[model samples]
Target: MEHRVVYLDCYDGITAPLLLGALFDIGLDLNALKKAMAALSLPAHTITSQKQDAPVSGRSARLALDAPEKAVPWRLADTPALLPPGTLKELVRQPVLSMVKHIAQTTSKLQKLPIEDVSLPDITTLLWLIALTLGLDMLNVDENYVSPLPMATGSRQGPHGWEPLLLPEALEMLIRVEAVWYSTPDNKQVSLEGAAFLSELASFEPVNFSVTQVGYGCVPGKSASDGGQSLRLCLGNLSPSSRRAPQPAPSPVQTTLEQAESETDWVTVLETNIDNMSGELLGGLLDHLLELGALDVSYTPMQMKKNRPATLIRVIAPPELGEQLAMSLLRETTTLGVRFQHMQRLKARREPRTIQTSFGPMLVKVKYLGEQLISASPEYEECARVARERNIPLADVYEVARSEVQTLIIGSRKKT
Candidate 1:
């Protein structure tokens, strides 16, 4: 069986409660989730559900702040005293520790406090709750692959970041759903039955993942406010191409003949609107799409109704990968729905080659037929780096790269 990975692009921000709600929406048995949370020995936080109405339709799940009135702090200084004897055995698993690290980081960011300022007890309690959610053996501890929490950004506020206690369990549900979702056939990504439930609930398009493993964590705060508490779920897996079997090399003429034989290539254009996504998450999603064999993907800034800023995501991928890619758009970003259109295209045959540059080697996509080189351009990564380091516009760097490549080939011909 092939293992897939799902990447959650948490750009705008993530809250523990929303994660929990999404989990409940996906099919996590509330009773089981509660039992795992109980083992953590935390405060008496209650979980409740309701019909959520987004711009699209109705959804059923737990509210992040079940009852703001009933809220009480689970302070760090009181952790050890609260834990049941030997229950520590089940509270220190990898899933638990990973959650602790994430929750602590988010809390620190929310409070605008240093990670150094976060109480150790709070971290411990968070970890214990994660263990409780997973029902993992306390003795089965292992190091995690990725670091906990993202590096703190400059924008943050408040004293303590902790808010929701239901996030970890909620994340466990999402992790499980994402794992199973990634395993469905490529066509399922955009099918009415595949992402229908999630899309309707969140009012966003969807994101596709080759999800292999999922790890859960919690963040303090509520979703109503920008940086409130939430759950962080890490969906891990490789890109689609990496999963494919190797193909034998073809001779130059054979490749040309095969290219001629290939019918007009068709692809779908996917578009979605997102209000809460961060710039960082958008970048990650685009990179992921390219890795998944997308021909092109881009985002544009726009003002959504109510005068709030938003982004419009656009992607062009092979027809087969269309569904998964579209779902990924909704799953990873804050988009509720996505529009799709199919179109055919004609392209000159192309080959990928590397060209030496003044800074280093740069990759170029060259379109050609027989001995004629029709067109070529420097890779975007190289151009972007040069533009940033030199404090120049990207277009300027592109012009320079093209000039350099042309000069190199022309000079070589003269020398010959």
Candidate 2:
């Protein structure tokens, strides 16, 4: 089936209203969206799309929501209480509900808060309704539909300060929606979570396509330059491929089992020697590096020349991040210089799986060699969190997560 490609150019920052307005402008049916909201038992809110003029993007869309009755704030746990009994099951189908659950899970992890403590803004619930109405879960497309850059506006406070403006659940929902494409130029400043979401969509290669339709969504806020705030949603279609004459197949290359088993990729290893830095400073720097997406960061005590004891900071990261990591080492530590080397690494295919545990849901990293499962371990950070929240030993949380994942895997095998 030919699927329409949708690109969200958030020239301004994105909000739930902006997103829904853009989708609406791009041909989403209002009645369907309203119907889904009714099924969810949410308070009545009116969504209207209107054309407005902007200095930068010219004609754009404006979306307004009216829900005066729902003035009280609600958390994720409050969702069930807000809706009628069995309303979710009766109104939302499995696919849409699954998408909603996934978004909630991602938001919970991102915020480092218990699922019950995490607040669901009104805009977020509305976005879910739009996703359900548009059948976002059923779209046929690869992850490449989203852009690489994080979503941001050119404001003076910088991207880090703008984090509060984003709704984590809404952001996750947008990324996983199959057919819809989210894009921005390379020069834009995207939020950290927005950039992370975009990275998941980076596996898709660019295709040549033409714009078939365009829509604009505008926010009521003012831009830094006193211009109007808006975003463009472009609908594109790939041109038909021309028939070509068939050619002879190329011969396959033969390789030994040892060679196949020894498949390797290059990674950058950054090292810096610090003798004068305090342990507290070094520890803080290490945490910061890990937060910035370092694959691994470790330190080893070593004796330097003249009997001075020093710490060797080692960072393992993708080759693309070598330069940035090196700069960080210089800026954040007392290191005058940073040395890096490209080393070959052999790794098994690894994927993350989530399992429900007594404490909560924990993410498990599972590794596979061909079709055979090799190693499965719960993510240490998540397990540690569960332990802290549940007032249990960390080891206990790990065991429960591991056992749950194993049971799930076994059950799936039996079904197959």
Candidate 3:
């Protein structure tokens, strides 16, 4: 059965409690939530959820720090002599690493520090790891699909006093929000894109939504006065798609995965190495390729002449688009030539999905045909935000999401 998951947008960003609140709002069993948490490190903290009126009407869950200042203290933990070859390999499971890195970078903006001096977890890598562990489908994050929030000019006090209001990016990085839009402190209006994303996720009409449970994660931010950062987690469930929505039946059709795999298709793999191009520029080019029908594009870190750091970029696409996309690469970056490969592909298909987790809602993209789900990835935005707030493993959040999504789908089928 096909399914579409709706997500609750945190306009101001997300908090551990807020995630719990959102799940409660949509209807999640508290007993199931406690059972899930009990499997993790315990005697560490307390999670309490209660009805609140301030943020409209919903239940709010708060994580009372057992040891207020207790965090995974970096200074106290083992320091890497050289970042250990695959030490970062663990980051694939830790979203906090990514959040911490993001916080460190954004803090550099607020405090005027160097990027190299900043240190933290690799949140992006961690989200990917967790999603992989849970067997949830992943999506190609279109950073180019940037929707900007309205800017508010003025001064406001943060942890410090009388400072200019931090822009959306700064706050988003600070609080670890997935998708955010700026607005006056007083609720008046919202960004068009932000509003649209929310409306689309919540409407649940032709696409009815059924929630399972919710969880919470904490956001960890480093203040000069404070030693380390924190995060919270939250989870929820939603309906996929309705097979019996009562629509007119179309003409009979038969599609076979085996036949699709047998079709002739030539693909070109483009590769290039340039030391001058910024990661941002390279990323943009990759985005265009995917949008232009390129099958896949990625970068691998490598060393250039004189042992200088560099990246080996690879792009795969149909042979017909080779020339046009090559031109795009040349025009967009400083690379002079792109290496190519001509090869035949078996089959290709991409499906986007949303799952209710103990933390919140996530959209996972899967690739497969027939009855098999070949690959899975959890929605990065959903996993990253909850991981930051809950101070739990991003992998665990992904695990819960993967488990719940399967449960919901299977449960729905049995009911019908």
Error of 2 at 230 (Å): 2.8
Whole-model Cα lDDT of every candidate shown, in order: 0.48, 0.56, 0.47
Shift of residue 6 alpha carbon in model 2, Å: 1.9
- Per-residue lDDT for 1-416 in model 3, tens only? 21324333443333334444444445555555545444433235555666554324455545443664544423201223323324332322222233334444555666676755643332222222222221111221100112233334566565546754444434545243344356544322222222222221122223223433332222222321231111121222222222224456443432355544433455778888878878888788888889988889988999997888888888888766876776677657776455554455655576787766666667876665544455566776777778889898888887887777666656655775
Native-to-model Cα distance after best TM-score fit, residue 361 in candidate 1, in Å: 7.2
After TM-score superposition, the amount by which residue 391's alpha carbon in candidate 3 deviates from its true location, in angstroms, is 65
Stretches of model 1 off by over 4 angstroms after superposition: 1-263, 354-363, 369-371, 380-401, 408-416
Worst 10 residues of 1 by lDDT: 185-194
Candidate 3, position 319, lDDT: 68
Top candidate when judged by TM-score against the true structure: 2
**lDDT digits (tens) for residues 1-416 of candidate 2:** 23346565655644344455566666676666556555655555554555555533333332334664554554545544554435543223322333344545677878787776666444445344434334332232211243332443233443456442344544554455332334443223333223333333222333445577776666543553454466565667532231112336533422432333534566779888999999999999999998877899999999997899999999999877876887788668866456565565766778888877676677888876555565677899998888898798998878888888777767665775
Q: Give all TM-scores, in the order shown.
A: 0.32, 0.41, 0.37
Give the true-structure RMSD of model 1: 17.9
Q: Rank the candidates by TM-score, best first.
A: 2, 3, 1
Predicted structure with the largest lDDT when compared to the true one: 2
Cα deviation at 416, candidate 2, in Å, is: 42
